[model samples]
Target: MKEYSIREDDLTGEAIAALLRLHLSEMHQWSPVCSVHAMPIERLRAPDVTFYTAWDGDRLAACGALKQLDARHGELKSMRADPAYRGQGAGRAMLDHLLGVARARGYTRVSLETGRPEPFLPARRLYEANGFRECAPFGDYVADDFSICMTREL
Candidate 1:
């Protein structure tokens, strides 16, 4: 039986530290753009960002965040599923939960920036399956062959 729960919370210093380490050391092993490597976890804990962690029994299975860019806009951030649970639909579950939160909060649009690498194909596919489409860069992102920008209107 697969049981899991998703909830928004302030990823504590310890949890955030561990996540940052995995994102930097493990994920970066395959990703070329490791910009999130330098971001302090406190940034995600900011007033505008709502971060969520998914747990399967006390173990963290996945996590993601929705950052309120403005009144009607939000940006997806730090979407990662534990490598151990990668193929179990945890990522998709986290994504659907985040989108529901954004929609319920009245966001008019949601955008995300993901890598353009072979390892990122699944991530991009997940977004596309949920209706995200390629778009011009927004927020602090710029045009980079390695970074693919995507957006979806609510």
Candidate 2:
């Protein structure tokens, strides 16, 4: 496998924009419009969020973000691996990078919200494999059949 490098993204590159568009498209496909919680580029650029892009040399392999919920908690947002790079460790690399950022920020816990449909099984498995456990909704999320929330302690 090619070496993957993760970097904080400014969300200004064309490749980044294209990847985000693809991420939102996939999210909408797997979940109802009302249930889709993937953030747009503008939201990912907000003061409390940090966006990252992973590269396999010159190719963008994945992207993800972490949003500070409070001094001790953070939320994972918009985690998506490029279709061409899926199952190639890019998602794991991105997840690890974001979690490291959360730890560096002094967060004691990190959580994420994702669709509950079959299309999301792989993502759920990835999180579960990384020490995240299903939990009650956190942040502004609610208990709904279409959404599942998971959290991990730093």
Candidate 3:
């Protein structure tokens, strides 16, 4: 397997935009319109959101983001691995990097909202393996049947 590196990313790049579009498309397919929480590229560009991408040299392998919700809390957003890079640890690497960033920023907790459907099982599993557990909705999110919220204490 090729080695990949994760770094802060500018979402305006063409390759990054394409990856985000794919992530949004997948979210829409598996989640109801009202429950789709995937952030748009424009939203990810907001000042409070720090976006990162994993690259295998010239190839964009995955992406994720951390959105500051408060002094002690952060939310994970827009995590996705390129189809070609799925199961190759790209998503895990991106997630780990974002978690590290959250810790470095002095966040005491990290939370995420993801779909509850079959398509999202892998993501939930990934978070679970990383010590995230089911939690009530945090920040501005509300409890919903289509969404599962998870959190971890940093």
TM-score of each model, paired residue for residue: 0.89, 0.97, 0.97
Q: Write the per-residue lDDT of candidate 2 for residues 98-119, one digit (tens) a residue.
A: 9999989899999999877889
Where model 2 places Cα greater than 4 Å from the true spot, the runs are none
Task: Name the best candidate (by lDDT).
Answer: 2
User: Which portions of model 3 show Cα errors greater than 4 Å?
Assistant: none
Model 1 regions more than 4 Å off: 1-3, 13-16, 26-28, 31-38
Query: Which 10-residue window in model 3 sums to the lowest lDDT?
Result: 1-10
Question: What lDDT tens digits, residue by residue, belong to model 1 across residues 13-132?
Answer: 466468666865755676564443224477878898888888888878888889899989999988888888798888899889999998999999999988877888989999999999
Candidate 2, TM-score vs. the true structure?
A: 0.97
- The sequence of per-residue lDDT tens digits that candidate 3 reaches over residues 41-100 is 999999999999999988999999999999999999999999999999998998888889
Model 1 is weakest, by summed lDDT over 10 consecutive residues, at 31-40
What C-alpha lDDT does candidate 1 achieve relative to the native structure? 0.82
Clash pairs for candidate 1? none
Q: Root-mean-square deviation of each candidate, in angstroms?
A: 2.2, 0.9, 1.0
Error of 2 at 11 (Å): 0.5
